[model samples]
Target chain A: MNKKSMYGRTARKIGCYAALLILAVIFMFPLYWFFLNSFKSYEQLFQFPPKFWVWPFRLVNYLEAYMYPAFDFGQMMKNSAIITITSVIGAVLSSSVVAFGFSRIRWRGRDQVFVLVILTMIIPTEIVLTPLYLIYSKLGLLNTWFPVIAPFFFAKPFYTFMLRQSMMGIPVEMDESAIVDGCNVWQRFTHIILPQVKPTVLAVVIMAMQDQWNNYLEPLIFINSNSKQTISVGLTFFSGMNATEWNLVFAGAVMVALPILIIFVFFQKYFIQGVVVSGVKG
Target chain B: MKKYTVKEKRAIRQGLLFISPWLAGVIGFTLIPLLLAFGISLTDYNFLTKPRFVGLENYITMFAKDPLIWKSLGITFLYAIISVPLQLVFGFLLANLLNQKLKGIVAFRTLFYAPCLVAVVSSTLLWKQMLETEFGIINYLLGLIGIGKVSWLGQTGTIIASVVFISLWQSGKMIIINLSGLQAIPTAYYEAADLDGCSRWRQVFYITLPMMSPTIFMNLLIGLIGAFKTFTQIKILTDGGPSNASLVYMLYIYKTAFTNYKLGYANAMSILLFVIVGILTVFVFRTSNKWVHYGSE
Candidate 1:
């Protein structure tokens, strides 16, 4: 009986590991495929038995893809950086201010305004796509970064919700003590609320960076000029007319994804904390 | 120095003043755009043409005449229903496994989440290559296993599955969030269950699951919302092709506005979609009260 039970336990252990191994493989396949194809020569991309490893590896594909674009790769990266950084700043600053008001201030119509802000969460961007496009056109903001950047000035409902929760988590006595010492509301916010909610702000910044960096549709729709295109929009240039350059596309993808992946690797703890804190009240 | 009553009122006013920047953005950008979109949806508005007041014509056509509208809606719902639940389940299971204080947890978490951070165009193109019938690694792998070649994106039946698979591949964030949720649950509950001689399965069903319900509910809500807005993946990978079998609602709306130049029709569709999203979200939130557990309570 003891031997039979031990066999059963061993089988369960094998089953558990087997299940995990299969899942990890499935999850990792595309990334592996990505790295493999990025190194393959154009001729080798379509070969049968699909060269699992790109042996006799070629570096020309990366060189060719980057150099062919007049090395706008740097410019493209710069454009993406500018948009992402500014948006992150705008999002954090505005969202924190709005969140401070919501959490700290007691005023008439405050709750009603908060409710209306949350209502904005459900309004699909697609619903406003046409009108906003038309309005942007009228305002002479089309093809410029203004349309993309302007939205961040609004205390985004999701971030506001996140910051408010973070703010509320701090003890109210901190604010009261600061106020008693002649620290006005703005000073109190800058010193007390901001410091306490730094993690939330960092989380918001990361989320903002991710969103702005990956933003494709807005750039595609708004920007007509090639010079103005963000990387997400500029990436469409990779899809060639007769054939999509599998190698070049993969290289470009690796270039684009590498930065965020690197940042995330270093900041996994904060990123996870941000998600948990945000999701709790989100 | 002044303990004046009016001074207190002035301080409150200044507080409002400080937030005026956000207020302007709210009224000028989001709220105005939303209202304008609604108004435009009611008119015969194409960008090239003047928006004449058509008075419910767009809505009527959307509801009454357009079969494709409903079909797209059905497709979006199917995609959301299938993808969201699968994401939730897989994410939860992965989170549960990873919460075991194992070595290399951070690296594994990053590996799982890295796909999502991949540039959309690059990754979508990569997926397109992978989903190819002839040169794709997916089929090559299947052949190695002695399975027949599967045309992942080429066939009508398989296209949606292909898209869903691509999405599931990028669900590292969701899994990470779920892992955090799992960790947030106190271990004492599980310990007590073990002490009571409850089976592992029973402990999960009773202790872990109920404790994690709020997080699960949030995941469901977010998954549904995000899936509904899925357009770029479709636009890049399939372009609603393989006989329009994978055309989701957002993609349909986009094509209507941009390709067909039917702005009014697209806006109508968008409003309908907004209503659908609102109704669905409210329904989920209402039902969440039944299952979501507050730790304090």
Candidate 2:
């Protein structure tokens, strides 16, 4: 009976591993297929029984796609970098400060204002999309990065709420001790709240970067010029022109996705943490 | 009211100062634009032309005249209703599977999430290519099984399903949320159940599931909201193609606003959508007390 129970336990363990391994392969297949296809020649892309592997990888596809004259891929990458970096810095600074007020500071009508902040999240962006577009055009901000990047500097609701939830967890006594030392609010905030919630700050930064870097619709609508276009928008234009050219499409896709994938790999902890928290809250 | 102390007054002033950016944002972005959307819905104005006040004409046309409004709403509602719950279930199950205490499971979890790291445009395009009738991998696989080439994107019936399938590739966020929720379930309950000679399936049914109800409820609401707003995938993949079989509400609002340049009409439609989503969200929250197990009991 002991031997039979031991056998059953071993079978269960092996079965669990096998199941997980199969699911992993199935989950990874699309990406694996995509990466492999990016290296194939244009002629080979159409062939049936698709090449599971390619010999002498056509590294030139990356070169051709990047320097492809139509879309100005390099310029678009620069544009994406500028927009993403500015937005990340803006989100981190403004969200943290605003969250600090909501969590650490005591004041009249504070919870009511915090409730208002949460309400802003419920309203869809469509309600604001047309008016903002019209207003931006009136302000002569159309086709400029201002319309896209400026939203983050204004303490975006989702990020503020996430950071606020994290901040409220730290004991108020941390602030009281600093307050007794005659440290002003800013000093206490910087020395006390910010340092304690370092992981969340990092999470906010990565989330901001991911959001801005991958944003397609904002750029597509606001920025008209090819030179000013972000990579996500630029790739759409690339494939639009070269719909039949599978090789270039795959190459362009790899280029746009590689940087974020690399960042995600190095900072898996931050990505998962941010995703979990933001997913729950957002 | 009682007079404020010096510290009380100081705290109020400092709090307002710190949150001034959010105050500006609420006024500039939310309140002002919401007022504008309502005002615009009553007027007939294009981008280039001066606003001509047409009292209730946009709303009137939307409610009584437009031929495509109901159809598009149906498609959008169907898409959200079917896809959100489907994604929630699959994501939860995947999370449960991954929640096992095996070695190197974190690596497996990362692999599942890797698809989400690819930006929307790139992933959509890859899926589009794979769904191509002749040269695509999806059809090639079906052909190997003695089935004919199916036009995944070109057909009216399959377009919505195709987008829904494409979306599952990025269910990593949902999985992560559910996985975290599962981890937060105290192990002691399961330990007690094991001591009681409960079967593994029984332990899951009684202990694991009740603990997961809140997370599932949250995902249900958020997923529905998100599915309601899905645009990039649809616009890139099919663009509401094959006789508008898959034209979602947001896509129509977009086409009306930017493509057709009917700003007032689109604003009216957006207000309509806002009402639908707002009512749905409130209804979900109100009903939550019935089903969501917050562990307080």
Candidate 3:
């Protein structure tokens, strides 16, 4: 283009970079600060000017955090892993099966039931919290992991809808070809549709795992025993008990947050794509 | 009416079989609990005693006598109003920036999006420390500029603002969604705008904004609902504290049910919350047609 427009373009690019740099720093500051403080001693942590960097990194903070007397961080991590893995597997399998039924079959009431599935998305969980709690209590499943993990086996509407939408985009001819090869509905679903929607299934798996890992309120309410708590709830109680020790608190926070962060970093493409699909489709 | 053949009957049966788990879940977990919640809302159950049918007594008390309900609702509305738009604007602006072709853009995007992955409990606890009046880095930085330290979570005036600030800090998901919307806009439109000698500002106002309206609407709806349902952060950070100044609705219901053991009253609060959210969602959907542009239409 013209010289004036070229200069304007250059200036705009520079300005954009500047703005982005500032925003990036602002966004990353909390995590950075948290990490920096995690290694600081109590005196260093409470220093008036707030030391930008710890003199000698106290890795013992992590050790203390892990061995905190009030709650066992190792046990908490195990509980979190168990809950997250089981729930993700349950949600993925159940949601995919239900999605296949909705998208692949032409039942009389299919559309009507799918509409009900969509409607469930808008109903806030608060409405069912009390009664669900009572039902679990009545069933004598209150303190167990059943309350947290069992619901996923039933199929969450949001994940079901997401999977169904993606499954619908898979060509019908694949299922038809499978049927011609003497495949029943279940075989076709397993052999054709499941393989086709593997990417979306992976995305759903990661999202479900993230949700289960980060879930707080459910664990807080249902799993009252300190030993049974997930990382999220356990960390909160840890922080409360060690409120004065900022180093331990930050250490516990880091431990609680690290796995999800690692997952996001490694699987960012799927994560970003999942966010886009959900946003656009909704 | 056409009669179904045997083949069609099998397909129907198989379909039902596939979806049976969901049906069972809906019956046992969702629908039954919802009906039971409505029933409990009309009673005086405290989890320790049998639910005595008081017949709308909880709702009546909430409406007529309980002032915290109104105050908490007002606080929640304020939180939603301020935080949703703030997040939307920040997300939109950042998305526009990230849409540019640049080196290391992916790294920048990841950095910005990382906060969204942080667990709410941890993030709240981290922020609680960072906003501490005496030892917080925030006040330390303010002190450097000759500004006095402010009790971010302590003061009534600053409590909501602090909550909003922390919420906005995790606007990464919104940014990702907005970036997708931005990238989805056809580049041909911008090229055409350039051919017509349109200014960048005019192009954004006329073309980009309209094209992105649907995405914006989606973000707005999600943001509104999310802000209203905010619990873990407030509960961890302030515990609706410093005189209940930051008591959001969900925290109120949670405290009422769990801490006070007033299950019936909490259910009443929950039913009210559900209706309010439903109405707000319908209102948005109704208004969306006017402003939310679809490319096909």
Candidate 4:
């Protein structure tokens, strides 16, 4: 409680808060700037000292982006909604079920197979792109949502691994007692194991939704037809156009990014927890 | 083969049955395609015609004929080497700062992480405007400081740096990971250090770091792997501009497949890319024992 050390401690705390506040602004500025600029007029955008305040919120660029016949932001939204919703469902369901089998069930070679799954996670998906393209084409699934949606129905290694870790943490007695009581494997999975790993399940849902919603590469590669394409590719075309409408591009970006941003804001706890679990126990 | 108890047999049956979807996926998606990818690499296939066997030609073309492969590979490595270390070290530093007991720390963490949640396309689009050669905000800001316009995404001299700049704010993921790792360490360690008269820096080096080594090493491995696959933002911002100076390896493989209709050669390049990634991953794993500390008491 000496004055000198106390003052030094206060000074350090102040400096810490100041540094964090400054860094937060630096980190958040691009997103803030992007949102603000989306509301500016072309004249406002072109001005030397760019407008910071979003006075008189501009709706024209948003409308123009939406009605811009080629891009069709509405259809893209529907496509993304379908893909994200279905992919989330598939990822959560499959990852949970597979993790149960891998974790709760004792089988010969299970550990080895689980190790293989984790190892394969390191292989970049690009390595499989060319051959998968051919396979999809031969299956006549190109220009269809099937290719985009089918992969998630299988246990993605990372999600499966994470869920398995959580599932394994539950005391063995819970599931074993259920098993002795004539609770079948499926019953054990659904009634006992699944309920225990609900938080991880929520985590899986967030990640799967995030992955599919922001997914640009797979959709671009798989879906060739204009009508079937997702929002990311449509927005890419807007930005890539030589004579770009900066306002419209910003507006389009806002449209693509806003939904997930809202979701992230609400479920910030789960998102942080999800990542922590993945890292700490991973 | 050894016989199993009926109960054990039932358990094995249930496990396999439950993971059947994944097993099916391995055959339908991964196994078949991967085996076929190796097969395709030894041929000359375009979408239009049959794959004519051209044994080792694509591999030769990759190593000997295509100089861009080496250049793009070098560029990708440079990108990974630059971006990933920043992601790890900066993320750890920021995490340590945020780990301090403070008011409204959650809000600060969220704000820092918001950029990472933005759609890659949107984030890239935002940056493309901010870095546009003419009428760019960055250049406009620079004018106040008496610096000339520096064509960030245009010139070869600064293209990688420009791409690296956009990626800087995205260390949010690493920050979160590091923060969690930091939080997981027992507070008793720090308390003990204080009781022993350890300086703040000494406590960090002696207590926090050794405890956090495994987590930091995980971030390094994941960051490097993710860095090598960086494509979408660069594709949107520059599209390998200024005569392909910014072309990362995946972008090259993509173009080689879709644009040039060299499916066979593209598949070959992809396998090589995988080999490179595998080697790097193994290399990191091998080095982990030298630094990464396992669980403590």
Candidate 5:
């Protein structure tokens, strides 16, 4: 009976692994296909029966994709980098300050205001899109990165909430000890509080970077000029203009996804933690 | 009330100072835009023309005369209803699988979660090509299996289903969350059940299900809201094609505001969407007490 049960357990383990292997292939197929096709020439790309492997890989597809006249991939990458970096920094710092207030300080009406901040997460951005557009246009921020990046300087509700939750986990005695040591609020926040929540801050930064890097709609609306376009909108235009060039389209898609892919792979821990934290709160 | 001391006053002032950026953001970004959106919803505005007062006309037209509104809402509801449960179930299964203490589990976790890292436009474009009726690998494979070609994104019947399938392909985030939830479950419960001679299936049914109900409920709520707001994929894949078969609510609102230049009408539609989502969220919360098992209980 013991031997039979052990055999059954081993078989179940093998079954689980096999099922996971198959599901992983399915999950990763789109990406695998994109990478394969990005290296194929036009003739091989449209071949009947769909060649999974092609001879004499066309590495020039990447060059052509980058130099496509309708959208300059180099300029777009620069724009995306600047916007993502600055916005992410602004978002993390400002939200951390606000989160510090909510978590560390004892103040009247703090909880009530925090509730309002959380409520903003439920309010869909579509409801405010038009008015925001009007506001941006009126302020002459149209066709500029300001519309996309400026808001991060103010606290974002989701990041603020996440950081606040992380900060709350730290003991209040830390702040009290800092105060006794002649540290003011800012000093305590910078010296004591910030170091303790560094992991959460890193998670927020990575998340903000991903969001800003992949952001499409805001850039599509705000950046009318081709030169100002980010990678996401630029790739859309590139694909639109070269609808039939599947190789170039695939190349562009790969390029647009590369930065975030690298970041995600390297910071896998923080990325997973951020996602889990956000979901577990719900 | 007791008289305020200097230290208390100083702390209050410092606290306010720390959160001033958020205070400014709430006023300038969220509150003002919301109020302005409400005002816009009550007017006849296009970008070229100044907005003129037309009190409740847009809302009336939406509820009373607009067939597209109802049609889009139906589509959105269908998308949410179908996709949310599909994602929750698939994510939960994958999470359970990944929760095992096997060798190389981390590699499997990364492999499963990598798809969620793909950008929206890239994934949508990739799927659009893959789902093509002719010369698409999916169809070719189907033919090899002795099945006929399936127009994955071409027909009205299958368009929404195709979108849901694509959406479910990126359920890695949900899986991660569920894995975390699974890990949070104490092992003592399972051991106790084992001592009782309870089967694995029974242990899962009773222990895992009840313990994970809160996480599952949260995913359901988020999935519904997110599925309703899905835009970039549908916009790029079909653009509400095959006679608006996959015109989810946000896409409809987007087309109205940007493509047709009907800003006021779009605002009204958006307000309607807000109310619908708000009502649904509250309904879920109210009902959650019946299903979700808190630790205290």
Candidate 6:
């Protein structure tokens, strides 16, 4: 390469690296801010030149956030756990079963129904919010977890598509062999098919967990009672008119966001693989 | 294999049985709600009162009478158009950079992706603090640069800009998706370009650009759809304030339905949005064939 071209390449490379690093810092700083702010006392939080580090690190905010008005953190965590676990179970089981029908079965109008399922992806959920609210209210399911959890029992489109793609990758000969062994479809599903797509199933579980744990709008609109409120909604109370307490709010946010962050960090390889696998198929 | 009647019936039965739960849920939760929403669009239904047939009055009023409806729709369009292209371009650039070999690349990628994983509500709240006029960090930084404190959220122009900023930041996920697509391109293309004495810009033009088109197309469509439906950020950040400059279509529809108790009007607005989004999506999908290059024929 000519000296000028070499210089140009070096400049470009340096430029690219610097830009990415800067953007990354900008993206990450707010999250870092929340963590650091959660530990700082009220006066320290507003200090000019912004105290990057503070001594005598305080656990008081977190504890106070937990203990304030009977510190419903444990209960809220339990609620999130229950919702996430059940939703994941429901989403995986139902989507897989539905996916089997879509991918493997040759029933009449199956393609049509599958198209209908895909159609749901394009429409905004807000459009249906009112009608759904009416229906849920009429069914006496409002203020209960039923509205939140019932959708999972029905296959979500994304999950259904994910499992269907995974199932399609399995050879038809496997089903043929199972049939030759005089195994029923259910037995084949349990012994052969389910095990083959265990990773995809785990992917579905993790996704469903993340979605439900962070779910805010649905619970906000649907659940009215404090007792039924999920952690997402529970944390919203901190930002209410009178209190507007930054310290406690950051603590609550940290509490709300930590579990999913930890889960993502630990299982990111699986999650990224899952995303790529699903995306490539789609 | 013996094609026995009973066996065929049993397999079909099992298939239906297995899929029955999903079928039930789709119809119950999704299809029924959609249909009811369509039906409600024709009536004067609020939550409290029984739905009375209005026969397109809601839609007529929305289009012909309600000026706010148009303004909000305009805002939604603005938000989608402004943010989607910026996201695609920025995301593409980021993905291209990250596609290179670098030290601590994994850590850098993870750091970039972390903002996406943070709960949006929490992130919005943080942005709220950072943008606070008097004591916010952003303005504080601005003060050093000899710029006076600008009300980021309180003003019309700044509020929309702040919402756009939040949307742009959230584009990191799509950037990762783009990165994956970029990496999927084979090395042979670049090698061939090099052998042809192709310049960097030309190689990107002839090879990377065409190969990544399908992913770009997908991202664009998804981004457009996602942006049009944006509510959480608008709700948290500005609440569609300062003379409704930042009021998005969904937030408008939401207020119409829940706050104003105008379900019929809301449904009409929704149906209008639904049609607009659908038309745009189909247009993109149809035109995608022209621009998007798939690996397989």
lDDT of 6 by residue, A107-201 (tens): 65577777676667666676778889998898898888988887887888778877886787789999899989998777888897888887678
- Calculate each model's fnat, 2 decimals: 0.47, 0.59, 0.66, 0.65, 0.61, 0.44
Once fitted onto the true fold, the runs of candidate 2 whose alpha carbons sit more than 4 angstroms away are A1-12, A107-115, A240-244, A273-282, B1-9, B196-199, B202-206, B295-297
Off by over 4 Å in 3: A1-8, A104-115, A171-183, A239-243, A277-279, B1-20
Residues B235-261 of candidate 3 have per-residue lDDT tens digits of 887899878988889999999999999
- Stretches of candidate 1 off by over 4 Å are A1-21, A69-72, A104-119, A277-282, B1-25, B295-297
Clashing pairs in 2: none
DockQ of each: 0.47, 0.57, 0.60, 0.62, 0.58, 0.47
- How would you order the candidates by lDDT, starting with the best? 3, 2, 5, 4, 6, 1
Model 5 earns a TM-score of 0.93
lDDT of each: 0.78, 0.84, 0.85, 0.83, 0.83, 0.79
Quality class of the docking in candidate 6, CAPRI style: acceptable
The sequence of per-residue lDDT tens digits that candidate 4 reaches over residues A128-193 is 888989888988988899989988999887788778877877899998799799997789999998
For model 1, name the residue pairs that clash: none
Candidate 5: Cα lDDT at B271: 84
The stretch of ten residues in a row with the least summed lDDT in candidate 5 chain B is B153-162
Candidate 4 CAPRI assessment class: medium
Better of 2 and 6 by lDDT: 2
Residue lDDT tens for model 4, B197-292 = 789999989988888997888678778888888888778878887688889999999999989999999999988987888899899989988988
lDDT of 5 by residue, A1-282 (tens): 489889988999999999988988888777788899899887777777898888678999999998887777899999999999999999998999999999899887788878778667666676677789999999998999998997798988878877887787788789888878999888998999998877778778876887788888888877899888898877777555335677888888888788888887888776666545443443
Identify the candidate with maximal DockQ.
4
Over A1-282, each residue of candidate 3 has an lDDT whose tens digit, in order, gives 799999998999899899989988888888898788789887788888788877679999999999988888899899999999999999999999999999999888898888788667667775688899999999999989999998889988877877887787777888888888999888888988888777678778877887899898888888988789898888766545334567887888888778888877888877666645543444
Q: What is the per-residue lDDT of model 1 for residues B8-77, given as tens digits with 9 covering 90 to 100?
A: 5775676576566667877777678777878888888768788888889998888889888878787888
Residue pairs clashing, model 4: none
Which of the predicted structures, 4 or 6, would earn the higher lDDT when compared with the native?
4
TM per prediction: 0.90, 0.93, 0.92, 0.94, 0.93, 0.89
